[model samples]
Target: MSELVEHVDERDRVLGVVERGEAERQHWPHRIATTICRDRAGRILVLRRSETHSRFPGYYDVMVGGAVDGGESYEEAAARELSEELGVREPVRFMFKFLCREGTSPVWFGVHEAVVTEPLIPDPGEIAWQGWLTEAELCEVVDQRLFVPGGRKALRRYLESGSGSGAGELGAE
Candidate 1:
């Protein structure tokens, strides 16, 4: 059976529910949870998507994220993505929401940040590998376009929003 998720308009008001695949095929605006995590030393956790991923396979990502499941709030989905992809249930603070317009991967994206004390354990199903990078190093990687194009934009927004310094704002979409 196909999982259903809330479908929304550009303003992010729920229009109805639809199957994930159908939503993607139609480019319906759905919700996604994007999260960036850091450790005590303030090194950011960067991950690479699995080669088998349906979208952006084998692409580097500055965040761990996934589609928001049915009935899940953005905050809930952000935390869930962190737990599912990194085995960390740390508190994720929502930064902002944006309508990504890069290409076919359009969606209402919620940016979040979390701090972890435990070691990160990446799920092989979702992530190919994981590593910790300093903020400067992350800038270099982003400049190199090592991450998915949309993901790179999100990361840049997150950084400019001052969320990396423990300040985050919930910007309107």
Candidate 2:
């Protein structure tokens, strides 16, 4: 399916409409996206992007993520992505938001983390590789630039804050 996207100013207010490709190419107004991080036992789930992706192909990143639909809240978008990408429907706890201006398209991104005790059933087309990593090991991977730049920053901030709790400002009802 083609991506549905909108251009927005630095404050995340809509400025105009643009095809996803044009927005990325021109770094038009910022867009909204979300990342989901899941922990199981003492390890976190991470995945390598399919080499076919338009951006950051072959890079390892947080378990699940995608662009938020117009008018969808970050939590809603995150939960939808979790289920679509991993076939997991567990509740997601809010982490934080990260602004990524380094990409072809600047983005206002939300970060979420969840704990999963059940086995994951990931979509092969969406993920090239998947594995569990300890927190320290994950940080090492981040240091080595394994994850998308914005993802790395969000993960670091989440870890440093020591709050596994949700932000409370937004939640799935």
Best by lDDT: 1
Candidate 1 per-residue lDDT over residues 1-173, each given as its tens digit: 88687889989999999988898888898888888788888888888889998778888888788888878999999998889888888999988999986645578888888889887888898899888887777876665655777777787787677766522221322
Model 2, C-alpha of 171: deviation from truth (Å):
30
lDDT of 2 by residue, 1-173 (tens): 66766677777777776677777878775555455555655566788988887668888876477877766777888888888888888788767776677655678777777776667888777888888876766756665665677766666566666643322212221
For candidate 1, the 10 contiguous residues with the lowest summed lDDT are 164-173
Cα error of candidate 2 at position 52, Å: 1.5
Runs in model 1 with CA error above 4 Å? 165-173
Q: What number of backbone clashes does candidate 2 have, counting pairs of residues 3 or more apart or in separate chains?
A: 0
Candidate 2 deviant stretches above 4 angstroms: 164-173
Judged by lDDT against the true structure, how good is candidate 1? 0.81
lDDT of 2 at 58: 89
